[model samples]
Target: MKADSEFKKVLTLFPVVLFGLAYMVPLTVFSTYGIVAQITKGLLPAAYVVTLLAMLFTAFSYGRMVRAFPYAGSAYTYTQKSLGSYAGFFAGWVLLLDYLFLPMINYLLIGIYLNAEFSAVPVWVWILLAVTLVTFINIRGIKLVANVNFLLILFQVLFVVMFIILSIKALVSDGSVQSLFSITPFFSEDSSLSLVFSGAAILCLSFLGFDAVTTVSEETIDAKKTIPRAIFLVTMIGGGLFILVAYLGQLIYPDYNAFIDPDSAGLEIAAFLGGNVFKSLFLAAYIIGCIASATSSHASVSRLLFAMGRDSVLPKKVFGYISLKYHTPVLSTLIVGIAALAALIFDLETVSSFISFGALSAFSLVHLSVIAHFYIRGRKRSLSETIVYLITPLIGLTLCVWLWTSLSSSSFILGISWIVIGTLYLAYLTKMFKDKPPELTFDADEDIKVSS
Candidate 1:
């Protein structure tokens, strides 16, 4: 496409990675820390490690696809261009579940934490405030959003680092510095592979927004290189932070059963490690971090809708329209903010699982797209190439499937229902196979590269 018709390529590496981190929301490591600990039987670090490795594999596949496509579409573009139109439509549809609902889930999570701290404000009020603030920020534009995310991510990281330091100090004062290092965080008498894997499945939700970096590919400078690098960096840095926080958390609060409220376990750990002062600090950090997350989620989902709409998969007049002044998909952005209001009706645990299923399902398709694009279509027959194209993505695909199986039955029913709805819509769009699915028209001069 002509440069004038595409997203402005202004973002460099740092801001892009910050956007991804903001979307991932570093403080979320603690938000769900308690529940993951219970699942891992107190070996939270082990669970994080497993989840990180799986995410890394998926991140690699995403990087490969980003290099090949270098466009606005995320897994949808990748799968459609590499696999087929129908598969691509379904991939985009499944991903909509993640992109559209994520803001709601984050708003709900922040509401839970903030409500626990200030019950008089009411959680629904906080959710409303979050939707309003996040929607406004996103509609403003990507550059402004990136600048805001840089500050928000800095606050989240500082809080997490301070939390870790305080927890270590508490451990040392009780005994000595030696107490800071404990094998119990990774392995305890009750820990098992199955439990850790299950925990890893749930923990996968923390990695949801990393791939969202790809949604802004059109706006990224040197997108073919920058998008892939940002994906790997976000996954590694975010995963490392999660592992460290979980380790220190387990060390400070060793027993899962000891928590007064299993859902808010990190709160108890905050109190034990740093008293009421730190507990209050942690709550504030959690709320801001979630705000940052919702902001990024809104930005991403809006872009995805723009891509689909531009392709005529969605209503071209509405989702395809961009605000001439703000330079954003205003209608799409507003729809997301409205959808997030569903948080008022649903609880945290259920919505979180719902987001996970959508993300992992889309991730699995991305991995398959890599295999289909590289191994089957490219026809490159080399040992290293084979490993990169086939075996690596195979591992990623397997992990995504295993995680999908680990989700609750309700998630399956709900997620499948969403897909079924999408399938019907796709049929309508394709006219029951009488016509091809809608696709973006590219300029003949566009320097698009196929990985093959």
Candidate 2:
């Protein structure tokens, strides 16, 4: 790759924020609404509140790290630079669970919704079609994916607005204006702090976009400034939207048990609010948005694999190879597509648990990275510096650990299995820790971009 062919610093704050929001897929609040509502017993908003608070602190840590190392690789780079290559390799490995399975989650969602609406078609067929389409588009190039995601994101935002308005209107029609105000969404007799924390653990998937923006640091202008600002903005805006939509949805339909299908509860709510027409529109928009999201995640994990492979962390020939014709990581993209086929076996809730586990693990590592880099290594131990570097990150790390406890036993089993596998691989790669693990380099020939 020529120097001139490298990533251009053309992105500004607004576009970067849009990219982050798009990656987040704001409508995802609906995707997990029913499951979370059931888990929290109608305290979805409170769960989101807990999640938002956790993300805010971690976002602060991410900002500090980006200032120190303004590049791609996100948490992996931060951990490697601050800690050691072995820790960093594990960070990237664990994070790969989040990145690799996210597309699978979207595929699972596509199958769930399309199968719900069109029962004649098998769910595997929809999953296959989605995987093929997303893989094809991603293999083509990133520019086309970017343009498509922009329009998809606009439609998703529009759908969320319409859903909120319709929910409010239904609330008013059902009772008086007072019907719109309810404490039950945040607190009810059945709701407990433990349940809310568990819900928050699942909902952490909704906040993945804030950290995703850090991957674009190398491509953004004034990335140290722009990326941090984008992270905070994305987290706040996305969290607020999730909280509001969940609040309104809960207010409109307090009886979570009434839904025929918990996974497709949002569709039932849409149909109740408007009619079949609105529900159809909701289904279409959501499927389209999931496709866009799947494409973005597919491309992201592919590039991450390319980075690790280029560093000889993975097999250089397979994982690191880029297609000459398309100028993309074709092999890695196909691997991700094949992995996404796991959607056929896994259900939405289980897959979400897996993603949340990976995400929470990475978040914990980032907080530790901040303390390692700024508080311990830099040694800026003034009272203010200690608070900024030590106290804040410690708080973030604590919250992340608390959330981890809330994850299901299945998540812990699967997550630990992944870690054990990574440990063995790291041992072999480094010849039993006698040599440092190969560090991943994010800036390389392959294009690293993400879209919704």
Q: Give the candidate number with the greatest lDDT.
A: 1
Candidates' TM-scores?
0.95, 0.92
**Candidate 1: clashing pairs of residues:** none
Most accurate candidate by TM-score: 1
Can you write out model 1's per-residue Cα lDDT over 1-452, one digit (the tens) per residue? 12223356689999999999999999888777888888878988998898898899999999999988888779999988988888889899989888877888788887877787798999999899889988998888999999899888888889988987787787788576788777888888787988888888888879976799999887888888999999999999999988888888887777788889887887888888888998888888888888898999899999888888888888867787777667778889998889889999988767876788888999999999999988999986599999999999999999888877887788888898888898788778888878889777554336332110
Each model's lDDT comes to 0.85, 0.84
Clash count of each predicted structure? 0, 2
Model 2 alpha-carbon drift over 4 Å, by segment: 1-5, 174-176, 321-328, 440-452
Residue pairs clashing, model 2: 292-452, 293-452
